[model samples]
Target: MSNKIPYVNILQSAICIPVSDEVPIALDIKILPDKNIPAESFFGVWLLDVSGSMGGDRLENAKESLIEQIGILPDGTIFNLITFESKVNEIIKDVKITNKSRQEIIKKIQGITERGTTSLYTALEKSLEILRKYSRTNGSLAIRKIILISDGEPTDVHVRSGEENDPNYQKYFMLAKEALEYKSSIDTVGALGEHNVYLMYEIAKLSTGKYIFAENEEELKTKMIIATEQTARIAFSSPTLAVTSITGDIELEDAAQYKPTVIRMPFEKINKRESKAYLRSFEAGDTYQILVKGKIFIDKNNIQTETNVKVLELDFDFGKDGLRETKEIFITFSSDSSKFKLNQDINRKYANVFSQAEEIADCTIRGDAAATQKIQGDETKKID
Candidate 1:
């Protein structure tokens, strides 16, 4: 294992697995930000919903939270703030925070009031536009994030009817796709349990971001801070893990991420023997665990011989930084069954992840949106 990389660490559940028809493997990867790195590398666009529903404590709390976030942001951090109701308003644009501008930004946030209906999609569209434009001059290494906070469903004519087929609703997903093009993830916070849960969840998932539910009005501030803090700690952007079967006969099957929120990850198959899993931005002091399943075909004649076999190779890619390191995994074949040992912790995690996945699927098929949201919310809380 190459340990030269100081920013990230990778750990596996077992160095060896029993040589059988199929074996499971798990990797616990931890990424730590270098404190010496400049904070200017982080860029954020915050979308605050000022729809009429946000008139009272909701709006006030949001303002306070935004102000608090601004106050705590390290000097030289680049951020933009936008508020939307029936119209999209850009309160600040491409502002790099410093001692002089911090107080000015807070005053602008405090002046925000609520009116009109929620233009959720419009707000998202505008924010992504700003980030996309900024990325052109600033480059891709910066940690780009969009934090959207809303207390109610979208009130746009095409989306308010709850029709998925509406062109505007489809456009919402397209916006998320566009976000990926700019290497930006949209983290969403559904405040007061009234926002469209499925919409918030899907957009965040599609963008490889987090979806947080502030169950009550008071929790919104905390959740917003949590989201901001996570983005602030991003050490590496667009991290991907590529697994290759070196032995040719070991067919890589499926993979899923079990930590930092349990959701099925899109496992891209490069070939029958190789696959890749794209992870969200890596944050300092945060660990991500992934479980990969594979099938190994042992030669009938060779199975009788006790030998060590090289099974898999992992290549870690850190966005614009390219492939940082590689690790190879091996397993042993032996006639003595006593040599076989199982990593119970990994097994349990695999079981729990798949179980939750199945429950989500069933809920979706039954058109139980509430149940699906509940399962997702419960899984998210587990990581907290």
Candidate 2:
């Protein structure tokens, strides 16, 4: 018997709907897991950008936030700190940390002077390489994160004339692409870069991770703390299938004016009695969950793993079940301008459950289990 769960994210009834005002959506998943897992059984990588742009309060705040994060990891979680500048620095290579080792990592964070230009490509390549290598050797489910923290574009790094084409941004994307292809997540944080928020958002979307943009040092720390803290607080993955079925959505008025009042459902053994339950109801300005608690997963052989997500819709349908059939919602997630906003809301609503997903991702990261280093930041990194 293989140990994998596979499900599909389906958006039934309508492709798009209109709303005069915005509404909130909550997630509710139901599943059956074999056993219990701890949050610490995962692996994570902190890819910090130490370019000239990261100087002063930005760099200080980055290190300060990281030091505080190290103390929060669970017992078996492994952390690799990758800082990038003119080159990628393995500030702390796959360190199995304890309270004592945590102090050492903090000491190294202090030694960083924050000089040179940003080399995001190299750092991402190295981070993915480590993740793949560990995944290959460990032979267990792991969640590897390629966390890139940058405040600007690649212009500052000035890719070498000949080397420019050698390790281009595409290469880092390929690694990021592979992580997404393999059901892993990649989160990015760019401090003091409101103009560069779009780029960070792309990286996060491609890898099923979240991106944070901060315009100042204070917001930077708060965002960073929130992102990491989320890893230890959310747990909406077990006992149910969580996958985002629809990536792009539009208002009905904006969408060719097709209300799609109702669609038919198909079933081999259609029962007239259950027909009423299948009819979707719709109102002018009301939003509905087209598909509620829909199960979706990826099958890695028999290890059916489910991505914790909910596929909701703003439109509802009231139709006969005669045409009801399981649909494989086929829609490639294009770069929707609204996706970033929806993703952030979804993340915040399920922040508490995500802590559990972090545990699942951590178990997949490679490295020997060692004690964690304990480093507390100046009483200021709190995410109030």
Candidate 3:
């Protein structure tokens, strides 16, 4: 017998609630793949903050982290380094990873010094410019990313002292707005210094990138490694689930937008990630449509793009009803009391599990050990 491999498979479990007019359904969607091939070509930008606040040990540790990161990246990946203070300075341009270039990068990294105010927005823009310019050169097929390491907010007294309605007030917004337009992902490293964590978190979240809040130099190095490794291991880029049709009061839970459902699948975190949308119907038989669309860049020589949509038009013994089973979902509605109870029990059990899972996630995000332990105990009891 010959073996076969599948790109994706859906194991769907669902629960439904009956109503006077429509049926409400909840589904648990788990997208699974037997294996994934990582992208080979990668272009990265190191936007280092050398502001005066990053003086002494902070600057030294940051420089060391940069050097270590450069030393560890796999060969054939291309990267650039830039330092931002009162102005933006590009220390290195797009150079393919090699022993010689790596040494040059490390030597330049050690030469960096902290002195001036932070020109955060300028640095962000400059990094994007470099990524865009080099991304198309030499017919390169690569994943692009910007690793922004900063110890403080964007501050320049010159911009602050300018005329009324200074651009400084809107620099963050401007950077975020522009960054969204570019396809390159941004991973932010907020080092321990006088800075706005919330602002950094928002930038990372909106860019669909990873946000690392480093409390010390060691953590900073670890987070950098994590970011680089995660970038290298990206299994999917620009993954999207598009909903083509909907009926009744069916609402999509995680849809960024509807009416040709555009699932918000960010480019940064795409490995085994889950996307969900919900539906509620007043009638027994109602249907919806979804199209899974994405492109797989195999290599510079061959880039494959595919858009697969769920076939929505179905014909039955009766006739075409403009309804069909979604690839990952099938709904069955009945008035049987016993069946209803079974579905209800399943729904309640999973609902409790989901609630506990969410609680654990919240506690973990907030770094609350006490709350996490309590919630974890509750989860264990439920599981038992």
Candidate 4:
């Protein structure tokens, strides 16, 4: 038997919806690489906050988690650890994990202590600098990720004194853009309830990464481990799905990802007939379902009573080996109501996504940061 396997499998819901002016569809994407294929080199940068706010249990738990994470990383994985307060300190440089170096890395992680104020922006900037330097040397095949754990907002004099319009505050956004350019995602962990959830969320979203909120010590450790494991399993990097209208005057209305992680995906309209959405890197064995809503302007006089109407063509661009896979989705238009059943699973996902979006907007309008964070975390967990 051949040991080779396809890099990805794209599946769409079998059931069709009722023919109307607007129709919604769901696509389930599975990324599976052959076990015989060599694993990509993993590059992970940890930006830990050791500010005064992260004292006692917070710091201790973070240290314990870091040590545990180091033990589980695969051999030959490049790791860097940087802890920041008023100043940033690089405890471990770009060192590859091996049986011997793993122990030394754990010792350095155990030695991390808390003091001074939070310098979140500075720490992030330094991490990106390192990632960019190594990415150029390693080429585009390496899997690069940054895990930022913070319990408070930036308290550095420059960041605090500057408003959002100031250069200091705007630098974070620039860093996120650079991370994207470097093919590195920044997964952010808000260590405690007091952390700046909005800022962390934006950073993660901008970099095509996940944002996790840890309410307590145990969650902090567990969530960090999950984030690291996901990064290490990445098999496909920076894939984008292009949706092109095939029949009639069809326009994409909305789109959101429902599985692996629950978040609204931003899409760009390329032209009147096509649109594109940027998807996250796919981990091996990972399945993602995206709910896409589109509007079709139908002329009832010219409509066929019983036929399969092709609506959209999905072109998935997997950023490796110049592989581009395409799939066409069709809906059955019938006069019999019995044959026009909707996929309940897809319907539920659509409802949940929009409901949560509305709730988050309400929370934001009322200036309820905690509530907004809670809604995001709860919705993501429920879907996961």
User: What is every candidate's alpha-carbon RMSD to the true fold?
Assistant: 4.5, 16.8, 13.3, 4.8
Q: Write the per-residue lDDT of candidate 1 for residues 57-83, one digit (tens) a residue.
A: 889888888988897786777879999
Instruction: List TM-score per model, in order.
Output: 0.80, 0.53, 0.64, 0.78
Superposed Cα deviation of residue 253, candidate 3 (Å) = 3.0
Reference-based lDDT, residue 322, model 3: 28
Model 4 lDDT tens row, 6-35? 355545553455556655555555555443
User: How far does residue 316 in candidate 4 sit from its true spot (Å)?
Assistant: 1.6
What ranges in model 4 sit over 4 Å off? 1-41, 157-171, 247-254, 296-310, 331-348, 360-383
Q: Regarding TM-score, does 2 or 4 come out ahead?
A: 4
Worst 10 residues of 1 by lDDT: 1-10
Residue by residue across 146-235, what tens digits does model 3's lDDT show? 889887757743233213245554555456545444455577787753455445544554555545667677766666776676566544
- The residue pairs that clash in candidate 3, if any, are 21-282, 22-281, 22-282, 22-283, 23-281
Candidate models: Cα lDDT each:
0.70, 0.46, 0.51, 0.72
Best by lDDT: 4
**Using alpha carbons, what is the TM-score of model 1?**
0.80
* Model 4, residue 92: C-alpha shift (Å): 2.0
